[model samples]
Target chain A: MIATDPTPADRSLLATLDRVLRGNFTRREALATGRIDLPVGRLIGLCLLLGAIYGICLGSYSAFNGTGHAWLQTLASALKVPLLFVLTLLVSFPSLYVFAALQRLPLDFRNTLKLMLLAVLVDLTVIASLGPVFAFFAASSTSYAFLLLLNVAIFALGGVLGLAVLRRATRDVFTPVPPGKALEPAAPVEPGATPPVLPPALSLPAPSSRTAHQAADQARRLLAAWCVVYGVVGAQMGWLLRPFLGNPGAPFEWFRAREDNFLVAVLRTIGNLFGR
Target chain B: MNFATDENLLRGGADVTPSARACLGVGAAGCALAGLGLGAAAGDVRTALFAAIKVPLLIAFVAGLCLPSFFVVNTVLGLRDDFRAACRGLLAAQATLGIALGAQAPMLVFLGASVLDPYLLTLCDAVQFGAATWAAQRVLARHYAPLLARDARHRHALRGWLVLFAFTGVQVAWVLRPFRGTEGFPVQFLRPEAFEQNAYVVLLDHCLRLLR
Candidate 1:
């Protein structure tokens, strides 16, 4: 079981989530000290809440357009969106944890879990914040293809931001810098002389050892592999829980016939939207 | 309150808490004055009264609907502590919009008096509203600059709020229709089919018709 810290008044789950997004929790000091005190349980609750908010927006498309009992589609979507992310994480997280252990990275299983949850929460929060926009468009547009395309675009944006934060957090937490190893100070410029321009290639620090360089490469490869796995699993999970926006012509169903994959469906939708 | 000494509104300073009432009063007064000029296009007193009521309503109603979501976003992004400052800035921005509208009211009035074509009057009203919105955005940017300097996330938050505000504003304006009364149609607060029609759907239909 992961150790629990005393919940302080100031460090509410919302505030902690905020700090995570702002890159505060990923600072060298916080990572080095192993002081990430995220409330996992409360955060899960927050994720669910955020997901439900966005789901309602997603469902609004159906509510406005779908035939038969459309409100149920909204309710079903609210329940399914959070489930989609959680299910995807469950499917993909074990390999990530095992990879971290193999690499002897700083992240233990618990921290890995926390980081994953934080990333998912970030994704959900962003999607929820854009709920109003989605609802507005959903209400305004009658075309099912247009709404589907718009949703894909919104989810893509959320996924990109979430992955970026995850990458940054993982890098900061896993790579421990030795004490007293700091960036070289800039040389003072002579009075009235132009400053030297450092080449972009020369700006980055050289790896101190061959093993460190290998480890860094391995970590980057692992992160890339894991991101692909997560994204694929997430897309498939969303596909499995189909009918997010109930088709205007058809009656509402929780899941549609799972014939095509996400990418194929998206391509078809784009083709249909543009009359190609 | 003395308008010039209202540092929060005038200078975009967050040190002092700007009065909410002052912001609302100024914004409503200015927009209402502009509405009076707009309604004069039809030379009808009742239409003028209706326009005065609706112009402020359009501004306030849109703001009201968009603010709750913005607050939630700000809280999650850890800007809750600065919520009051942000709100003050927003209100000041609204006040700026009102002032801009009020400033352009005389021009609208002049156009109303000189122009006989209903299309020209409608075009003039649209131009003034667009100009006022542009002016309001300048004030909003000025007020939000300090917050943006403090945290870059404010930039996204402010941008999101503006987009939501504009989206909802367009819909609300559509629903509260007939700002420039038709020459023959009886003057009423709203068109008979206001609620039934949506701005985006109508625009889309028009586009499709054009293509055909």
Candidate 2:
């Protein structure tokens, strides 16, 4: 039979995973920790100064690329940029809130940024590889199947990475403390002296059996609130924008002009109802 | 508390903590460099650099928000705050990256085309294939480093690397295969009709209307 106690290796792995999930420290915090000899804060300040210079270089490059009509290009880019940001932000918000709400762990902003960078890296990687393969096939007079495959591949990879990262975060964040081991001091103390008393605000209450049930109830209530808010807001917005987004062309023409099949007619009817 | 007491308290207290801060800074800088490298290789310096800067900012913001939530949840559950912090950090990092990409799609497209030259485009393609392999290896290494480090499991990492290589090879083959004697995969996928009706076209039309 397997031993009841966790192996040392398992413990170490768990600890490492914990560290990866929780932050190591912020630069300012590290300065206080005095763990390292170097003045990290000063270094970070210097880096920020350099970053400002880098931004100017990038802006100059943008101007060189004929995107100098700043007002127009900026306006155009800004419109689409926010739409994409909101879409992603909306999709990922639930996971973020759930991790924070359910787990109560400190989020590492730096690592979050790294993950974003990683996703972009992955996207670029896929695009890079796919470009050549497409070229080779095109040169060889191949079928267009590769295009569909490539798109599917890219989407699948992005989805997997997003899900993995989120799932890992959720699991790490919500990992339950084993019963009977929940109320220990955060730091070890010497035997002869009084234990280091955590500030009452920071000291966690002992885990009660009912707490899990209470958290579940809270989660349900929060989700319900979200649903109601989205439903009402969505309907109101759609109502307001209806005129601008209203169908301009004849609904019948869309189906009848293209094909006269029964399925097309049925689809056209449904489309018209929604479109109106 | 008095000013002296407050200063002492602040000094003693770990708001950000040392280890966490170091990890964040190093991770951010590494990501920035990786982004820049990828951008340069792809010939879209602007998109890459923007990604680099934006990612770190998003990480910092998300991490700050999630830390309190993590503290609350862990406190309730009687879990250690350290564990909670770790989980929050990882999630924040992942989410920040994803959001940054979504925010920068237009810049990516515009600069992607502008940056690529005949020679660089070829290099970009090769690098892309290699990147898939690189990513797979990194994931495996990260998830199973301890196990892989042992004598018995050392070969497993190599096996993982091989799997990625095999996957890339198949992709390369699929890309190079022949079907009809005409256009390539990208051209075929980018239908002319669809291109004509795209947002860019609409924007151009709007501009023309304004000019008129």
Residue A86, model 2, lDDT: 32
Q: What residue runs in model 1 are displaced by over 4 Å at the alpha carbon?
A: A1-5, A8-27, A33-36, A61-67, A95-105, A136-146, A175-227, A270-276, B1-18, B43-50, B68-84, B109-123, B148-156, B183-212
In the range B1-212, model 2's lDDT, one tens digit per residue, is: 12332232223222322343443444465445434443443344454565456434534443443343233223222234334333433433332233233333344344445653645643553454355335424433443343334333334323522443344433333332211112233312123332112222243457767777
| Runs off by more than 4 Å, candidate 2 | A1-86, A91-145, A176-276, B1-160, B171-212
Worst 10 residues of 2 chain A by lDDT: A245-254
Error of 2 at B141 (Å): 15
Taking chain A of model 1 alone, its TM-score versus the true chain A equals: 0.81
Candidate 1 clashing pairs? none
* Docking outcome class, model 1: incorrect
lDDT of 1 by residue, A31-89 (tens): 54343556678768878888998999998887766457778989988999888988888
Please give the TM-score that candidate 1 achieves against the real structure: 0.76
Candidate 1 lDDT by residue in tens digits, B64-94: 7688668756765668877887888888888
CAPRI-style class, candidate 2 = incorrect
The per-model lDDT (C-alpha) reads 0.74, 0.34
